[model samples]
Target: MTRPDANPAPDADAARLAALGYTSEFRRDMSLWANFSLGFTYLSPVVGIYTLFAVSLALGGPPMFWSLAVVGAGQFLVALVFGEIVSQYPLAGGVYPWARRLWGRRWAWMTGWVYLVALLVTIASVSYGAGPFLARLLGFEAGPASTTGCALAVIAVALALNLAGTKWLAWAAIIGFSAELLGALVVGGWLLIAERHHGLGVLFDAFGAGSGSGYLGAFLAAGLIGIFQYYGFEACGDVAEEVPDPTRRIPKAMRMTIYIGGAAAMFVCLALLLAVEDYGAVIGGADTDPVTTVLTEAFGPVGMKVVLGIVLISFVSCALSLQAAASRLLYSYARDGMIAGSRLLRTFLPHRHVPPYTLAVAAAVPALVVLCSLLSTDALTKIISFATLGIYLGFQMVVLAALRARLKGWRPSGAFTLGRWGLPVTIGALVYGVLAIATMAWPRTPEAPWYDDYIVALSGAVVIGLGVLYLVTARPYERGDAPAGDAVPGGPAAAGTAPSSEPSTRRRP
Candidate 1:
């Protein structure tokens, strides 16, 4: 691989990738802001909070806003640790590539497998979430047919955006980020200042008493609302090979993505919670969709429709970013002859250098998953829950892999080193990740079907089980390039062009 700490000129990112053993294929054209835009849009504060706000509020009332803060702090640790790791590796495939370099082939393959499923399910979930709003905008009944049709339409549009190539993606991301931020800022500010329904004390009122398990259960359920919001920061790292000065720029972009996206999420959620004319009505589930009800009241019918249109744009950007990230992850594995049909899947377009086959697979699978939405409401819920669990597991794998690697004498390289803070932060991230996973997978609602109760664990087992099955049965060929850990044998650095992987003695702030 390229020297972990090396920073070549703007045009040298590709040359550095070649030194790492692959040819220069991608355009490497995304600017730093474009990278951040992609991450922000993928995180999509408006989409995540807006979609889940009612459930969260119903579960924990106004105190649900506090859960966002807790999740945000925990996720910030994960993001900080990832920033350091991505700086050292700075490869495509995000968690998959990072895991491969930190652990080994089986680990990387499994990580990518989990994350790929997560991304596809994420695509489906985002599209499905958009369905109701789109239905509202179009004056449809939001039945199974309408929602499924809306999801398919979203998938088609996102596919077109992906096929247009990375430059178009960057522009879409920038536009989407601007619109989401504007929506969050403008809508949230208006809500906060326009009408005062309650005081700030509502935020501290733990309405968890309604749950039989007390405040703890309600808080845990609400925490799930924020778990999926913080992940897209890694989307920046997924396309690291295409970003100039990736080691420096990508790491910073990841951290900033979290900071900016988290702020927007909290701002909007708090705004909505405070803006609702009747907090009691929302907590009581008075309106089937409290967010829409509150927004429609706050902005009136026609005005709320316009706001929904902005939210629709945010969803489009979110889906586009998810598809792009997923395709890059597929290409990352295929680049090293790891995935099935490697030759075809890894093929980049002749001029654009985008991986068309991977993109097709990425788009097609999600469109298919949307069909599950047509099955029944239960199926759709389970499917979206599948995405939430798979993604969190993938994240924890990377955190665990980093922790294990550090114990094995791995010292990260790059200008963005964590220095003396590395071990503590990495450990904190791991602890938080494990706890978050446990909270999400705890079978919190026993009244739901056993399948729904343990949905995360069940879906997680299936995905990981399939990955293990493939690795064991096929005995697929592993390549000399893209080995599992740092200091890959015979890589460019090993050819004496740069210093060997360093001992873990130095400290940097």
Candidate 2:
């Protein structure tokens, strides 16, 4: 956690970046904690648990909380692999830049395409989920229409803060992280200490009440909650360029975010599950939300409302971090002329160091998606499942790409490295990723509508399919005439230069 290298000067930082084939353009204004807070807030335990806890409990009973532990262990493997890549490349777009650096422009383009869609949809999903909590806090009926309205409002405010400067977002994330952490510990601990509705063994009870995917099937279904909750840790690497000493700090931040955030998530979820007073009513009754029932029973209505108010802080901060990460992805792609309107997206506000067009795109897409909630919240929920699946796919793609690169004799020499442990670690992460995606995508619910069951996989396939179509048709050429680096040892001549034995040996004409 110590400053990896004695606070390198701006010139030295710029030089380090040049070795990786990029110029330091943005304002490196974020401090160490702020950098760490970005990932922590994005992976907000409060938001994840409040939104998905009830759904998981219903699917697989209290035993569903076990999946949280399983997913956390898998994702920690993922974070380690990401740490190596981010430390070496350290680009604005976390996945995109790493993919492009390791492979080619085409691979990078697809990575950006899929990840950007995932982030935007996630913003919309997070916003829609927040609507009910906010409406309840404000004493309004949280109908479809009202929730959609609230989501749009949140999108606008988050975009504004992102466009202003790092200072605004830094403080917002700090406050949100602090509040969410304290709220989880205090609230979760109180529920365990004061109210003991069920024993600890309840977490292992497989309530195979559902017709589809009996006990084990429902357990897999419940894994969706943990898979969705763990991803925001990657948000740290998304803004790596803006953080000081990114090579050292961002990797550490990435791992700690998962460690601390994942633990908090598991603790809160276990506490809430153990506090469930009646499994039959909360899990099987018509038109019941377990979160609402448990909160009201444990803390009374007034206290529940107060807790919901704190949850709003989490929702708002999540929206802000997601939007920021998405915009950076856009800017990273556009800077290399990979996407349309690249000129505009590449433009950054001189003083603010913010890419206005990218931020606008980030907010606008989510706003449009939120509009769908007006039709049917149920329909929107099915569609939002795509967000979780898509993100997992993106993460897996990077892991696979890294493993492939490693097999081809690509050694990771970042400030952080796995050395001999790289191959096994990446392989383990990929196995977990593949299983998680397949489980979610499988059509296990025969009683439910077909569209609902296959929605996640179908939608993700469509998005990736579209990216493939663009790649084949446009046949996009690699842009930027910068000097090459050793991303690939014996690959194509990068940047209008002859192939060389070493990537960094090639200099500009």
Candidate 3:
């Protein structure tokens, strides 16, 4: 088939079409189930497990389980907002395009910048966390060096599979995601048996290892962190353009993904609480890898090894999803001229119908991040977390802005409508977003030697700084006369204009 923007006379036009996923080069022919399967397979219960450890340690024990619940509820609300927008504007650019249509390009650029950084750091952090799981499974030491190597190896394999085109990534996600879910259920059941014999008193006890001074606030923050585990499920929406019946299927898939993943996570978290040996040991203790201790306490050596295997597989799946998400993000940004070397980064391999250059560019930073773990593990982890949270903040802003637009009588018909629930859900997401940001900086101690709060703050600043840099360097690329959603059906070019996909209302550039 001829590409949409293909020009037999010009290589430049052909390259442009290929960059936009219009070229026959890297086009994927996977069935809808394959794409949906990829989503289900990439998102597993282990994400909830790993994130639960982070929140529990930060906010204290048992109480942290409630935090996960809260995070899930808050995310449900936010997901509603996204569901509406995605159904109406289901495209590859995802949030950026939605925000640009509702808000403006300058703001959209900034939003995309932050989201891109968030996606990048997410990939890096998963890579870092994958190492310990592999080492434990293999009965090898899981130091910084070993973990880094394992992460790099996973990234290498996943990248290669992704470069093979959509089918391989889809199947890999299915296998990896399925194993993680089953393993989580097995571990949860083991913990449940342990809980039943031990009694349910600890389940009701709000007490934890913290000072009990600000338990509510701490739990709230912990829940936010837990919700972060289920973060990338929205990547399903980002790739909607590639999916068949995307307007109807993507939002449905998203709802199912979140609820299924959340329910599985909740069961495991409750079981983990019952099986916990030392609340203080798992909480106030500075162990980033609480899963190891939790499993060991519940199932002995055999259980610990099994849980480790599940976690390793989970991370591998997450790494694959992350890489896939990042490539699409880069491709989206480049197609819109938001990034440097738009033509090159957007180039697709016609034979495979894939964005090979975008994949290469996306993988470069993460590989560096994984390698840098050898130098300073603590620093890398802190920075990655900071970056992830910062992106979450940006997402919050965009959702609220779009919600506000809807409230002002701006309605677009789509498959997923928030309906009467729109205002309340949007409000809830905004409130939770504010609280989450505030709590992300907590447990700060002057004497702790290293503070993640400062790192998070600095990372946020750098993200904004990059946006500023883009504005300064790419001002000429900004199209001031682009139409809004109502003005163009397909995009800017559809309105008989120069196809300025930039946010049309903003003039700061």
Candidate 4:
């Protein structure tokens, strides 16, 4: 397939940026394929399904596979809403800039803060999850210390590739996308053809799973499988400035990520579900590692090792894309003077056009998070639970802001739009986001400590509370160093005007 905007004009992209009241700081080296690849790799079906498949299967039985379809449809609506928003406001830092222009400074700050933290946590979680695979592949014992060390190593490698520049990042994403997709197809197809042990009826069988409320409660609890798999599409818009004709291409890339990534995830899950030989054992908690057991039986020891290597690559790419997204968000915040050390954080390399300091922070924070694993075995699990909740909350904030903007008569004015469907899509996305957040934060772990059950909600509250305290005391929005609200008329496209070559006036905090 031909790449979208195969040879886009840099001047045109820069002009679009200028019209949006900002100069292009990054190289527009990313084609639509590159953008989609970044999002796809971030979504990383192989990583998400591999990490959560066993847990989801154990929690919701074979019926849990349905959650992928349910959440995919809902997230498709979100992608539509986000597509319209990004088309109109194709700015770097995605949710932050989109929210700011749609609503106000305060709203944008909070949205960015929540989303930023979630991205960082996600980076840590992905890296940490990769630890055991890496250790296993390297013939090392997968203990707490070894796993943490491997996690740090993954973070470092991803950070170095990102620091190399936009071109390298795009290439890495494309490579990772290729390897992961091929691996999924080969493995999933082989499983269905050769290793299938259950019939289609297995999907309906609950295997005596679920609590007193029955399969309904268990299935909802397994929603994380789909919720976690669908998000990385937003990473496409996060690097808006790096993509040519972003208003048009970014939206397409976002949707493609969901369609293709969701399909891959569902295929893998279905294959794995059909291939499981002992549903009763898995569902009854006797088989804690059903995925490994199935793979070992199907592929034998050496083939399983090769699959593990592929899984490790997927994890690295996911972490790499996440780090890139997080850094762009931090750069966006700093560029707007919304955070301390704004000058340093916003400094883009003259040649590479990447924010080194922000990238360092993105890497450093996750590395520190990985270190937390030393304190307890379950720290990683608690940390990962917050990642999904925080991300959904952040997404809902943007969805809510877009709805508010629509009610105030803010029609999307860009190369792409939903036309009459805009309001309905926005409303649907918001509703889905809210319900997903509730499901993620619901306490279901009655057998564990109270804190473990409430970790998702508590972690989110802590992040939000700290953000509120800082917002109230520091009042970052009052700085007024950058454009705070929507561009006049219908944005750069509708206005048919360009901002001055000079940077927006800066105000000291």
Candidate 5:
């Protein structure tokens, strides 16, 4: 792809700079550790532990590990594609901003709004999830009041961190991330040593010994569950603007995260599998909290309590990072005038040199969604998954668009292009994306619940319907291009060019 001139004229320079930060100059404050850690913490084994349970119950058992590998392979391809685009266009707007550059403003607006909604939904899920863990730690049930209180608290903490600026957030992430990493290793190591008699070979062979489906299917199903555990790491890309030289640094961080996080998750999955003496009981979906169930069985109440403590920490960290990602996404859409309350959502406090108000709004919206879910307990999981799947689908669309641009001869200005690996990787990611979407709509249970089977499609339709309404009512008000903000020369969104992959817009703060 031919690159756009960073700042072709004085007027262009001013406009681009204005897009960086509304109230202050753009500052790339995130480091390698922070970027990678942010992703790592969100996808740690603790989070994976729960995901494994969900997936196991959904698509058989143990085979979830094999499917985990499949999804990882799929994510690997998409990451490669992301590496290429992000290296070329490293802006905070992430997938949508990239889209704007390749496509045009209108489509970019649509993409950003859809993505923002999806991110908000994800935040609600994560925040909601933190409640039960916190409640359990405090020796209480995950009642509505408990869940809502925890959710609100988590959002409040995230808002505070963002208000403190990128350095503070990075430091907080580093500390939390370190704790999570060590916690996983400690817990997983203990589980392994306790069950060492099972033999290393058992980890590979224990899959279908009694499941009646044979080893292949059992392992595949287990892998599927394992896959969802690692799904949230890609949120790293959304925080690109915070990192210095993001085009170069973010890709490196993302790659490192995949390696470290993938190994860590796989190791934990193995530990859990080996530790469970009875696959039938462990995988029987007793309480839908297999990790806790396994620990309670293995080490009794004391051991169970310790493990729960670690899980609580992990949940808090994951919720924080997730909330941060959601805020950035909302901020990006608001900067482009895509959201309903665009002006308020676009505010940046000069004292904090961050969008404190916008961050608050972002956090509150998701919490409200969670509060709304309290009234419909039955639909909570389905609704959250449905919305999250829509966001993931949007991610796939953006990557495909980027790939198509490359195929049509859009070469990168930077040295980080995927080179010979682009087509194969892009194709794999797209294929996986389609499969994932299909799986969501698939009838997982023999007798599927009405909402479980169709929620993703239904919720996705509603999100799109809202987008259509905005297109008709708000499109004219959205400037053909984003308003001015602080930007650097040779930045991600190059001004004054017809982008090849996304909407042609310059810089998003």
Candidate 6:
């Protein structure tokens, strides 16, 4: 529970990085608020709730609101586990570097690959989700062409801001966090106070929405709202090298992202559910877009447009944060010479404090995924399904690795740790991750094509299989000269005063 320094010295941050077997390549300019904002924006309650609200309600009725709290509690455990890991490691790539130090090079390589792919897909998913909002904000009809065009445009703008520097990224995240939180509060508060049509008792009413196995199946299916809303917290750790006193600050920011982001999401979902004028229309498939209908009825066209503008900002910010995290993970991989074109990918632009090549890949891959949506109508759905599943799988891998390390006597030596609760928290996180993954990957679309029904599981298997194939064939880990495994003798606790072995080559501005 030690407080992080308000403004830790650059030398201290550099020394910590060097102690972990790396130089200070990224500019440690992000403040505590900025770091929290990055994770908050990536979580993007506005985007997650707005996109999934109708689906969740249709699947589990008013009781679906409980899923937010359920997933939040579960993910908070995961966040606690992650906080301890990142506190000790405080590495740039988040999960990848933590896994490397906790486990080994092969484990780290696969973890990074799975996580990198998930981040890229999430970028595409967020960008694509923004298309309709952007198109509507511009007074245009949202169609395949318009949506795809807008999605690509969003990617370009986010990429431009990211390439500007960590400063611009921080600014964007702060702005996005402000706008999204304010919008959610204003809208949710308005609906609750002025537009609520249903009584509080309605939340317990199943309203005949679940299948034969009862509401449990439906509630679990609707759990994606909470599962997806809680993760962007890890993005805080993804930029650890860019934040001063990261070992102390990043852990707090991760927890803050979950607590604040979860509350905002619950507020939005609750307001939307209670404001629905016709629950039957939503649950019975008569009204496909209840969010827009309710907002339009309450706010009229002009006010609804304004809200859509806010939602669009949330989406853009989400995509931007995802891109930033993706670039950092790629940079981390290349820094260790673990991928093709390592030199160029790891090239740091001291002036901008950004990895330009990796940034391009981050933007380009998502853009390609967005474009692929043009070929098949279900492509985006499949991509989104896989994205969520892939993220959860990658997270569990890290949690599992941490547990293994702990059992082998790897005590966390950082500012923030669970102490006596480490094992229990790690176990809870792993269990939660496993159940959540099963819920997400379960085949629900029995009527659709077999591939569509099993998209989440199949896509995940394919991605992991491909990563294994490449790892075995390319043997990138063996060729890398960079330090691997636990480089620090006794963890970061011993790093603060340790003399820096790898001094930074670039001049600071």
Best-fitting candidate, scored by lDDT: 4
Candidate 3 per-residue lDDT, tens place, 409-456, comes to 666566567777677778888897777666665545445556444666
lDDT of each: 0.80, 0.81, 0.64, 0.87, 0.64, 0.86
Clashes of each: 1, 2, 7, 0, 42, 0
Q: What is the lDDT of residue 310 in candidate 5?
A: 73
Candidate 1 residue 478 C-alpha distance from true site, Å: 3.0
Which is the winner by lDDT between candidate 1 and candidate 6? 6
* Candidate 4 per-residue C-alpha lDDT over 1-509 given as tens digits, one digit per residue, 9 for 90 to 100: 12344444777777767766677678888989999999999999998998888888888899899899999999999999899888878888999988888877888899999999999999999999898889888987888999999999999999999999999999999999999999999999999999999899988888888856777779988778888888999999999999988988999999999999999999999999999998889878899878888888889979989989889999999999999999999988887778999878888788898999999999999999999878976765677789988898889999898888788778788777888988888889888888899888889879989987888998999999999999999988766445545633354321123324455523245
Determine which window of 10 residues in candidate 5 has minimal summed lDDT.
Answer: 483-492
Candidate 6 lDDT over residue span 217-307, tens digit each = 8888877777777789999999999998888899999999999999999889889988998888888999988998989888999999899
Q: Write the per-residue lDDT of candidate 5 for residues 1-509, one digit (tens) a residue.
A: 22343423434323333343332233556777888888887666566555445446334544455555667677777777777777766666677766765555556666776777876776676677777766776778778878888877776777777678777778777877887778778877888887543665653554433355455444443444544555555667777766655656677777777778888777777677667655555555444565666677666877667777777667666766776776776667766666666567666766555666667766788878887877866534654566656666777877767666666666654536666767777888888888776665554334677755566677887888988787888663244344221122233342443223333222232
Cα RMSD (Å) between model 3 and the true structure?
6.4
Clashing pairs in 3: 25-350, 25-353, 26-352, 26-353, 26-354, 27-353, 105-503
Q: Is candidate 1 or candidate 2 better by TM-score?
A: 2
Candidate number with the higher lDDT (2 or 4)? 4
- C-alpha lDDT of residue 425 in model 6: 91
RMSD of 5: 5.6
Residue 80 deviation, candidate 4, in Å?
0.6
- lDDT of model 6, residue 88: 81
Deviation in Å, model 2, residue 390 alpha carbon: 0.7
What's model 4's lDDT at 343?
Answer: 77
When 4 and 5 are scored with TM-score, the better candidate is: 4
Error of model 2, residue 311, in angstroms: 0.2
Instruction: Report the candidate with higher TM-score, 3 versus 6.
Output: 6
